[model samples]
Target: MKTELEKMLAGELYDASDDTLFAMRLKARQLFTAYNQLGFEGTAARHTLLKQLLGQCPDTIDIQGPFYCDYGCHISAGENLFINFNCIILDCAMVTIGSNVAIATGVQILTAHHPVLAAERIKGPELASPVTIGDNVWIGAGAIICPGVTIGDNTTIGAGSVVTRSIPANVVAAGNPCRVIRQL
Candidate 1:
């Protein structure tokens, strides 16, 4: 039998309220709370907290605090990644971010979703999918990267856009239900 955490990471339906899952989220909240309280001068402290929080991260990462995530250990990020303040990653599943990526403030990378049917939704089991952001990508301010979506390398997502599908590399995408604006 798969554990709740195992099911969650496998993109399957799982109970978010499970005791173990709840404990993990609680731990993440505590770490992020401490991280958010530190000043810019507390770089070393901030890094230490992030190292303990995130699943996999490079030695150098510039994530402006006030960052929130559901299970910090589900997130893996590469080098030269700069995520601005107020960034939230609902990492019910894995969130893989590549190197040299710049995510603007208020960006939300959500991997959690619910069943479309109202009957299923009422059952309290939630579903999730992984989100992958390629290297050298820039997610504009307030952009929402939906579940199971992959943003290719060198792509630029415009501000406030809602990405519902995969975006190919070397293009500019924008707007609600973000579409390719132009090839770069």
Candidate 2:
């Protein structure tokens, strides 16, 4: 039998309110609170905390928080990544960001998705998907990357866009559904 965390990582419906999952979330929140409270001068301390919090963090990444995430262990980032303030990554599943990625402020990389049917949603099993951003990708401010979406390398997602689907490489995408505007 898979645990709730295991089921969650597998992208299957799982009980989020399970005791083990709840404890994990609580621990993440505690770390998040401490990390957020640190001043800009405490860069080293912040990095240290982030190292402990995230699944993978290279020495070259900079994230300006108040950052929020479901399970920090499900997030992995490559080197030279810059995540601006107020970034929210709902890593109910894996949220992978590659190297040289620039994520602007208010960007949300979400992997959690609820059931469409109200009856199924209320039954207590929740599902999730992964969100992946390739290397050299620049996600503009206020953009929301939905679950199971993949942004290819060198792609630029416009500000305030809601990306509902995968985007190919070397293009500019924007708007509510985030269509490809042009190729770079």
Candidate 3:
């Protein structure tokens, strides 16, 4: 039988209240909480905390807290990643971000979702899908990247956009259900 964590990573429906998953989230919360409390001068300390939290932490990462994430270990970020303040990543599944990416404040990358049907929803099992962001991408402030969406390389997502589908590379996308505005 697959473990809850295994199920989650596989994009299958799983119980969120499982003990092991709960413990992992608790550990992530503790680490992020300390990371958020550190002063601006605590650069080394922040790096240490992020290294412990993320699945892949490059030496060139710069994430401004108060960052929030579920299962921080599911997040894999490449070099020169700069995530601004108040960002939330619900990494119930893998969130793979490529190099040279800048995520503005209040950006939400959500990989968790619930069943659409009321009967299944009431049963309390959750579904998840991975979100992949390619290299040289810039996500504007307050943009929400939904589950299973892939933003291609050299893309710019405009502020306050809600991305519900995959975005091709080298384009500017914005607005609700974010659409490609122009090629870059």
- Per-residue lDDT tens digits for candidate 2, residues 90-183, read 9999999999999999999999998999999988799999999999999999999999999999999999999999999999999999999998
Q: For model 1, what is the error of residue 119's alpha carbon versus the real structure, in angstroms, after optimal superposition?
A: 0.3
Cα error, residue 182 of model 1, in Å, equals 0.8
Q: What is the lDDT, from 0 to 100, of the residue 75 in candidate 3? A: 98
lDDT of 3 by residue, 1-184 (tens): 9999999999999999999999999999999999999998989999999999999999999999899999899999999999999999999999999999999999999999999999999999999999999999999999999999999999999999999999999999999989999998
TM-score for candidate 1: 0.99
Q: Could you give the C-alpha RMSD of every candidate to the true structure, in order shown?
A: 0.6, 0.7, 0.5
In every candidate, how many clashes are there? 0, 0, 0
Clashes of 3: 0
Worst 10 residues of 1 by lDDT: 56-65
Q: How close is candidate 3 to the true structure, as a TM-score?
A: 0.99
- Which ten-residue region of model 3 has the weakest summed lDDT? 39-48
For candidate 2, the 10 contiguous residues with the lowest summed lDDT are 65-74
TM-scores for candidates 1 onward, in order: 0.99, 0.98, 0.99
- lDDT string, candidate 1, 1-184, tens digits: 9999999989889999999999999999999999999999998888999999999978878999899999899999999999999999999999999999999999999999999999999999999999999999999999999999999999999999999999999999999999999999
**Cα-based lDDT for every prediction:** 0.96, 0.94, 0.98
